[model samples]
Target: MTNHWLFWGFWVMANALASFMWGSIVLSATPAAFAGMLLGIVVFILVYGTLDAYLIKQNLSRWHDALRRSVYIKAGLQLMNVFLAFGWPASPELWAGIISVGITQDRLGIAQNHYPFGFALLNTLLTGAILSLMVAALTAIIFFIRKKHESR
Candidate 1:
């Protein structure tokens, strides 16, 4: 439980930073706003999802030598999912689909458009940040529980 909390905290902070960065880019564009937003999402997927996947796999492999095979397989599947979702075009429908899937997995809520320029930007940032935090929290809880059971 302690470990889960720690992991969740870290994830929330990371996601907050990521959201702010992406939201700023998305909201600052004059024309081609959608395109810019897409670009930002792509960058985020590449940097956060892919790179984090690698790091996660490495850590898991090191932590549980006997469970490496299964852990690696699961991580691979997650990476694939992230890649697929990231490659898809960014639209309200697409986001809705992603949010639905995430909700089914107990991840995060849907992203909605906000009012006013500043408010919209803040909301966008919060949406991403909160979702990322949820993912991290869930992942940490699962891993911690598994580790506890294994140890017992």
Candidate 2:
């Protein structure tokens, strides 16, 4: 907390590592889904980092509170992503948002031979949901440990 840069540095590094790992798993399935990988990392850092900061500033009064809120947000986003991927034609604007980040539908479409849209959608959603839960649990454990240490 005393060193702000250190906190941000660690945060960015951790986020990047998670993004790449997820990217790798995604690529393994689709192979030609490079655009998705890039979009996932960039959007995650920009969107999630900004939202997390704002939530901490406005709603979260403590570190643990922010982490808890983040868990909910991440889980919700994964569900939303699933819906966006599956119901892309219904809510077409979702593609715009994703494309704005540089991942075109054509790129995703190219992998249809190996990974159909539905298959990719389900795989991404399932993996993201599981990872989000794991991260949330880890955050909760860290929060409790820090609280306990401070209390003692």
Candidate 3:
């Protein structure tokens, strides 16, 4: 991360690849260059925004240990989604394999099926963002209440 060349190279390569993939998805599904680029930008922003927030939170944890617990709680709850997808699964390894393939198909293997990748990806991205925002707001509310109670 300290190496400037390496850092910028990562972003440049990522955006270029994203642009090409999104452009292809857009052109094939809807034939709109403008929409494809916009979609790329939107996807980039959503992903980097989350990453930046995560990085900042990690940096803050250098002094504030509670932040680490909150992150663990957040992640544990997030991990529940995959396990819950199986509804009390008895086998962890089987569930992990099934979830990996399911996610892979959701992202890449939609051509043979009726659901195209573009619309499905866009729908899921927006839905996930909305749900994430709601979770952040709720966490903030709980944090404020805890701070208030601790100050008493």
- Candidate that would win on TM-score: 2
- Pairs with steric clashes in candidate 1: none
Q: Which residues of candidate 3, in runs, are more than 4 Å off?
A: 1-71, 81-115
Q: Between the candidate structures 2 and 3, which one is better when assessed by lDDT?
A: 2
Instruction: Return the top candidate by lDDT.
Output: 2
Candidate 3 on 37-86: residue-level lDDT in tens?
A: 45544564446445545656677532233333343343344344356456
Clashing pairs in 2: none
TM-score of each: 0.36, 0.43, 0.36
Among residues 3 or more apart in sequence or in different chains, the pairs in candidate 3 whose N, CA or C atoms overlap within 3 Å are: none
lDDT winner, 1 or 3: 3
For model 1, give the 10-residue run with minimal summed lDDT: 66-75
Superposed model 2: Cα runs more than 4 Å off = 1-32, 59-61, 64-126
Model 1 CA deviation exceeding 4 Å by range? 1-31, 62-126
Candidate 3's displacement at residue 152, Å, is 1.8
Backbone Cα, N, C clashes tallied per candidate: 0, 0, 0
